[model samples]
Target: MQNNEELKLALLIASIAMLMMAFFVISFVMYYQKKRFEEEKKISDIEKNYNRLLLDTALNSEETERRRIAQDLHDDIGTMLSLTKLSLNQLSKMIGTTGDEKEDQIMKKSQSLVEETILHVRRITRDLVPTTLERFGLLEAIEEFIDKLEEDNNLVISFQANTEEFPRQGQKLELTLYRIMQELVNNAIKHASCSRIEISLESTEEMIGLRVTDNGVGFDPEKIKENNLAGLGLLGIESRLAIVNGTVQYEKPLNGGSSAFAQIPVMPIAENKPEPLHPFRRERVNI
Candidate 1:
């Protein structure tokens, strides 16, 4: 009888010990899995930050190069063209219609060509750096751009802002927004076969929003994403918006058109801050 009792106790103790060992093994596995997951997440976050830094650097470098090129065009080629135009005017005066109709016509055409070229250079410089964006705020700059686009093309573009008085966001954010707008507009023009576009800009306490709606053949944003079929224009817009910590969404309106909406967080403007300078008000001219 004593032997039987001892055997039962031993069996119970052994079973308990087995259970304890199993618990320990399960706990270890779970702990190990959690640590592995944490390590992978950390690595992923580090890689993402590194890539963002690289992208930011590349974009900054590109902007620097743009500024350099714009300055060169404006100061050098622009000056030379102006001088050439002046020289032509002086030559025309000196030759004074000595009954040489052909010579006079040639001089007039040469002057016209030089004037057109000068305007072209100015346009290029403006596009490269967007001096209007620097001097005026984002709204005015975008309006100026739209005006130019309307003057050149038959497509009608309508712009609306929440207010006439828009507070100045920082230069970097404004420029990024402007570039994104340009990309969206260009994409619509190039691919959408749209006749009319509606653009809206709104500013609130926490965020700035831009929406562009076009009456054209719409696209499936999800399909584009799944197939990795986004063109360079879409990719460029995404990259620019990402730099500014902004987001963009593309959707097809029920009315059978496409719309792109972008939003960026911004701090509330200080009332005491001075207004932006609109030194040279951009005049709408036929390009």
Candidate 2:
């Protein structure tokens, strides 16, 4: 009887030990799974934050563009149209006068005003979205833009490129890159006070790169990093670049100027690419 009691006691102890081992294994697995889930959640949160930033930047950019267009219409074309209307009213008053040289001159002046107003409207429309960019491609469009700026005789711009046979990378990429370049040029003209500017484009097997250098007062990239919202132009560039999986670097060159370099990695193009963005097609959502 004593031997049997000892045997039963030993069996009970072994069973209890096995159960405890199983419990420990389960606890370990649960702990590991919890850690993995937390890591995934962290990554998800980071992505969401980045996407929100992009959306906000885009909205701000759209608002800025709308204000610029409105100002152009009100200050430029609107004023001219008003003056032309006044000229027309005067011309109407003297229409019945006989062989008056002054009346003839007024009519001619009115015609000239109408023509000038039409030209101004066309120029504003072109700036909103260049037809050359839509049809001839990015390089030609940039060349034409530079040529127009040259006509103003305010600054000298030089363009160098290896883009004669550049492949179509879809409209989003093209438009984003073009806008970045345009913003950089505007900054140089408005802030840099640079006399000479250089723009270059190069392509490789997997990427396209653009560099813009100016001989002007250089900027501190650190300031942009610290306060991105300080300059809408820079913020807009970064957000647009993020959308296309591109990157930009800004530096104050040792030779006394500012330089910006951008690289856009190429992805496999779909057989059916989306249509290029058109000025009229874009919605101007007001904030």
Best by TM-score: 1
Model 2: per-residue Cα lDDT over 189-220, one tens digit each = 88888999999988887988889999999888
Off by over 4 Å in 1: 1-17, 267-287
Worst 10 residues of 2 by lDDT: 278-287
Q: Write the per-residue lDDT of candidate 1 for residues 49-161, one digit (tens) a residue.
A: 88777777877777666767777887889989999999999999876757678888999999999999999998888887777887877988999999999988888999999
Native-to-model Cα distance after best TM-score fit, residue 201 in candidate 1, in Å: 1.1
Off by over 4 Å in 2: 1-97, 227-229, 273-287
Q: Which pairs of residues collide in candidate 1?
A: none
RMSD of each: 5.4, 5.6
